[model samples]
Target: MKIIAISGGSGSGKTTAAKQLQQFLGNDDCKILSQDNYYHDHSDKFSGDGSVNFDHPDAIDFHLMAQHLKLLSENKAVEVPIYDFVTHTRKKETIPFKPTKFIIVDGILILSQEILRPHFDFAIFIDIAEETRYSRRLKRDVEERGRHPEGVKIQFDSFVKPMHEMFVQPSRVFATHIAYDNNSLANLFEDLKKDFF
Candidate 1:
């Protein structure tokens, strides 16, 4: 099995790229493991005072994700966690995930984590202007995650941008390919399909 890591700043279309690659490779041959699901539950700690740094690498359960990756590589089935964005916590139930020919690990911090890096056979980093990323994030948070526009802006300024610069951007050196947008990602996919599949 080949493990692909798709890392980028929030709203840089990491998930979309992963899904697109999965579709290109066929659903039966590829599966996606989202790093968002491995976020450490912060429901009890959230005070709504902008204290929580969700973009930080510390916010993720990298060890558990690494373990799951190892198990999957060994052809073992695993129960992936389900996270609730609104509550900022993980749900009690988990979704069972079986290994496939390819696994795409999607997240902003996946490439930043040393534990998870070795699991990836190939890595991709999506690059975009900060303004574009912020705009996309604002729309997605407000529309899909039930976040207020003002709150999203505040968090983007306080946590997301800084963390992206500190953690996410530096990790770009680890990527085998860097995609600027969906079109580039598609082109890269076409080039990689024969090599990987």
Candidate 2:
């Protein structure tokens, strides 16, 4: 496949699946693009504190993302933005991103916009229970992402959780594949090879 999208609500295991698929598909043949990389620029507008409402689709620069995808689809080089969530802004410099065969785009709101729909050959959704997602998010943010547990919990309660029902959950219906609490990357990897290779 030229491009595949791995999408779901935040902390729903989309990252894990994208990584597994990339490794299985091979680094030379696979490229992963996170929609998180396209987060809206708030440096000039909002305070450096990332006080902007990030849960909304308007909070991302989908136009830039589309341009990057068009470049890859045309077999050209593109620079992907590096986004720092802790700082909640993109860096000044972008790094080169070129793919040989497959491109895997992963994030929460990737598939929600129709502007991105025509770019994907296939789309997969990683889904988990609210309790599991919340728990996993709490741990990952606290440990890996350097986020405060209490802050994460508060965001979940006030924004993340409600937005899932408002936006994320409905997008699941459009997915070609739906994975729920299933960590069987090996089986999924092998199955994908049969389907795509």
Candidate 3:
């Protein structure tokens, strides 16, 4: 089995590509794990001041996530944490997953660290313009994620935007393949089909 790491900034459409790749490979043939699922669940510790800095690497339990990936690579069944973005907590349920031919890991900082970087058999980078990313982030956060437009801007300015340069953007240097265009559902499937075979 192969592990394909998809890395990009928020709103880069890497998640769409990962989903399409999974569908093309079929449910039994591939699995996807997202880094957001590793977000630190700190419902009790936070002060409700809206100052949580989630863009940092310390905001995740990468050690636990790395162990799970090792188990999956060994063909062992593992239960994954179901994270709730709205509540900033992991759900009570754990989802079982096993990869058949491949496991697609999608995230903003997949290659940002050397420890997590070497695990991927293939690394794919999704590139987009800053203007495009801001536009997509504004639309998606408000319409889908239920975040306020003003809050999004604030968060982006304070952390998210700067972190791209500090961490995420530099990680692109590690990618084996770089995609400039935002791959559509159909096109993403086709691209996966072309590569997997």
Best by TM-score: 1
Q: Between prediction 1 and prediction 2, which has the larger lDDT?
A: 1
How much is the lDDT of residue 171 in candidate 2?
88
Ranking of all predicted structures according to TM-score, beginning with the best and ending with the worst: 1, 2, 3
Higher-TM-score candidate among 2 and 3?
2
Off by over 4 Å in 2: 43-51, 183-187
TM-score, predicted candidate 3 vs. hidden true structure:
0.89
* Every model's TM-score: 0.97, 0.90, 0.89
Please give, for residues 1-197, the per-residue lDDT of candidate 1 as tens digits.
99999998998988989999999999999999999899899999875545689999888888999999999999999999998988888999999999999999999999998898999999999998999999999999889988888788888999999999999999999999999977899899998898974
The collision pairs in model 2 are: none
**Model 2 poorest ten-residue lDDT run:** 43-52
Candidate maximizing lDDT: 1
Candidate 3 whole-model C-alpha lDDT, 0 to 1: 0.80
Worst 10 residues of 1 by lDDT: 44-53
Mind giving the per-residue lDDT tens digits that candidate 2 earns over 1-197?
47898888888888888988898889888988989889876656544222456677888899899888888899988998888766666898898987568999988887887888789888888778898889988898788767677777777887788778888889888787777756554666677788886
* Higher-TM-score candidate of 1 and 2: 1
